[model samples]
Target: MPPETTGRAIFISYRRDDAEGEAGRLFDDLVRAFDEKSVFMDVAGIQPGSDFRKAIDQNVASCGVLLAIVGPHWASITDAQGNHRLENDNDFVRLEIASALTRNVPVIPVLVHEAKMPSADVLPENLKDFSYRNSVELTHARWNSDVALLVEALRSYVHVAKEHETEPIHATVPVQLPPPQPPQPDESASAKSRTPLFAGIAVAVLLAVGAGVFAATHHSQQPAQTAPSPVPAPAPVTPPAPESAALTPFIGRWQNTAQLTPKDSLLRLVVSNGGSQMLVHAYGKCEAGPCDWGTQPAIVDGSKAVTSAYQLRNNPQEVQLERSATLTLEPSADGLGVTITNSYQDAGTHPPGKALTYTFARATGS
Candidate 1:
């Protein structure tokens, strides 16, 4: 690492299969609290290169603090071979933790999703020490307090390190010398005597100059010559024309209860125009089940709007499916009604499955 990148940094180690969402949220919060460059999340910071292990080790060593994010399934998660990942010596998470421990770096175990600290018996030999370190819990209910504690700890460490770095190895005490002695009495007396003589000469010269200046001013004075031309008032400034109204046909909150699953699910849509383009944020209400809600940027062409494709993860099957939505708007007596059509495609499939449509009525307030 270069000297510029040597200062305090936080390294977040997490498993995608475990608590990627929590880890990502924490990273974003840390970035805001500290700085974007100071918080390094593995996947976002990693660069393409050979010797991936070397990269991980270097980052771990250089960081001021390492945050090991432990989700519910972190330890027991299995690899493709179906063996426990923590049991494998070559596992990336294991390597990262082990390296940080070996280098005596401060390691903080962050427990998310109400996860408990792993017992010593469950950890591999190299990672057994991790069980003893103090752990912090991050719950959705107390996210602010938990993250504040973590930030305070990291900031304290960085401050101490900086103070230590700036302290002088060997300080020198500045020497003091006595003030100079007073000048001789004869020299002082002569200087004082000459000061008054110079002052008298200056006073006489000023009086003569003042008399001449008074005479010149008295002769040159002229009375109010022809009432000074009346100053014209400034022209009244015209205010700039009001900006053309924004294209905001679909810019408000809309909600609807699906007939197929009435009372169980509610669909909500929020739309706003972004000058050159449009933005749509959709959320599927889940009163009785899991729901996925996300924002997608869309392009607007007249009444038609299409969003970019984004992936939706199916946790149970461990599969990622691509989905995109198109919305068409039509003016109605009550308000503008939107027709949302969503298209889904599985991996390796060309054509998408049958599209689904949902209707939404504009809400009262923006």
Candidate 2:
């Protein structure tokens, strides 16, 4: 309904059956921090008989960030697929979350009241650790602070969006990228000059070889000159060997598995079925060296694996080195692609606290 570039439009997803008032309040608060057009809500924007689901889908797809307002009954709702959908396949929440992810959009989950956060057992393996702790309280003052903090964070992301949309920052940031050097005439000239030197060396070698041959032939006749022994053959060279994988997972703070937590760091992984859940303990270490040996708890879900030691802290040392992956019996490139972030120290940081994220390929080996 409104012009898009409204600065990273915010999409709020909640169960209309549970806390409609809270969802509405959140939209109002977010609007105050952003523009009216930057916020999307069905009551405010969606028209009747205009394909509400499709409209929600499109808005969710277009939004730069999705805010999941998790209330007591949020996850209890059943979608058309009869699945408890929240940002996963067939789940509107999943659909919206996936779209944002695919478009590089961020999804922020805001828990209100007594709602239970989704754990590995209830959610797709990819989203298990994304659940926030008892991050939000229902109290008015805390709610206001949380909302304000979220707004501030959204604003920061919007600033990032604005900066990225404008002229590329890397282009103006005084990078060390060297300008392309023009072809030097001296290189070609040098090659040409070396040709004569090579010819001269060859001639000298030939003369020396001929002299030796003649001396050897005449030595028998003159008993004076002796031919020098032929030069020994040069030894063969060996190339450098590949690195070993002995010290992985412990190289530094690496995610023991796909759950987005640094290696060797302490994390609590809750795997649940129904209301019963089991806690899987793990540690994180910084991924470094070929072995990434510093990574720990080598055994995860009966799987023995290690994480890439690319991100020592926040530096992007390796592109193929996924910042994190989940510990599972069996792993795949896509099955475990969780990444860990270290922005949980700030009190007002939206989602307040943080947890290690792990990705899963299949359900589990066993």
Candidate 3:
């Protein structure tokens, strides 16, 4: 309301090869807590053929905080040759982070997949400070709790920025009226000036007569003053309202978004708990029959699903954690079906597996 300063946006920096999946998941979570426009990631917003260096500088400059996503190989990732990628001067990750550090923005190191902070000796001269900053970790064992803490720390900056955006900008411009002409012989300006002067004298005489008449009448002593009342306790803070159902299009059931048979694949989406929580049940093809992967929770954020569910293998041979999977949906043009982005993290690997996508029509009754 007061020119919208003292607030800032969030800038996320991560390597596509290092922690792209985690970065995307973090973006969705932040979007739910703050405005979508305020939580920005280059993958979803950047257009082609533009000067990316300028874009990185602009975004970093406007941000109040920057999240540096560090994975196990974040420091050691290599390009086509054998050399480490971070050594390159023109690397986008290095450029954006350098900008934030130079501007004194709060740079938060986000560790994922059990990554440790890179020592100052391992980092470039300008980026060495990144190792000393306090960091937060997002672990598979407790993703929700860890992120909640991070969000709590970020509230001070985000709430102000959001309030600034929600304020209505005044659009009425003042009109400049011409000055009145000099009061010559019988100009209207002189008549207008005389009107208020005469009105003032009449108002003063009326007030004097009213006060004299009141003084003549009886006057009594004022009543005794009463003691002040005690103050009431402040009310408890209520949580903000949840996202509207109209904005969340994926609020119903649908058979395998991949459209595979029970023998090959079987999955269903049951959006319960007011559409904010989801139960995903699925089965994969195996020897003899389908492997029933039990149901698990996937937190829904608008059209996207920030899944914490693990796909378990329930086959004749054994039962164990197969892969951690995330299911995100985008409805089709005909409004009859949705496209799904099924991303997963493998059991043995720490890095997330490539996300697989599928499109299917909404399933009918049972």
Once fitted onto the true fold, the runs of candidate 2 whose alpha carbons sit more than 4 angstroms away are 1-8, 42-44, 52-54, 78-91, 124-138, 159-366
Clashes of each: 0, 45, 0
lDDT of 1 by residue, 1-366 (tens): 434334437889899999999999898777666666676786456665636587778888888778899999999999889999998877888988998888878677889998977877899999986875556678998686556545544553353323232211122467687998997679778888997989999999999999999987787556646877889999999977422233365667776645646323226666655334455655454443423333445665565566654233212121233444455654445565556554556535644544455566777666
Model 2 collision count: 45
Q: How close is candidate 3 to the true structure, as a TM-score?
A: 0.43
lDDT of 3 by residue, 11-42 (tens): 88899998999998888778776767667685
Give me the displacement of residue 224 in model 2, in angstroms.
99
Model 1 poorest 10 in a row by lDDT: 162-171
Per-prediction TM-score, please? Answer: 0.42, 0.39, 0.43
Show pairs that collide, candidate 3. none
* CA lDDT of every candidate: 0.65, 0.48, 0.62
> Who is ahead in lDDT, 2 or 3?
3
Worst 10 residues of 3 by lDDT: 313-322
Ranking by lDDT: 1, 3, 2
The local lDDT score (0 to 100) that residue 284 gets in candidate 2 is 31
Among the numbered candidates, top lDDT falls to 1
Q: In model 2, what is the error at residue 291, expressed in angstroms?
A: 25
Candidate 1: regions farther than 4 A off:
1-8, 159-366
Give candidate 2's error at residue 205 in angstroms: 99
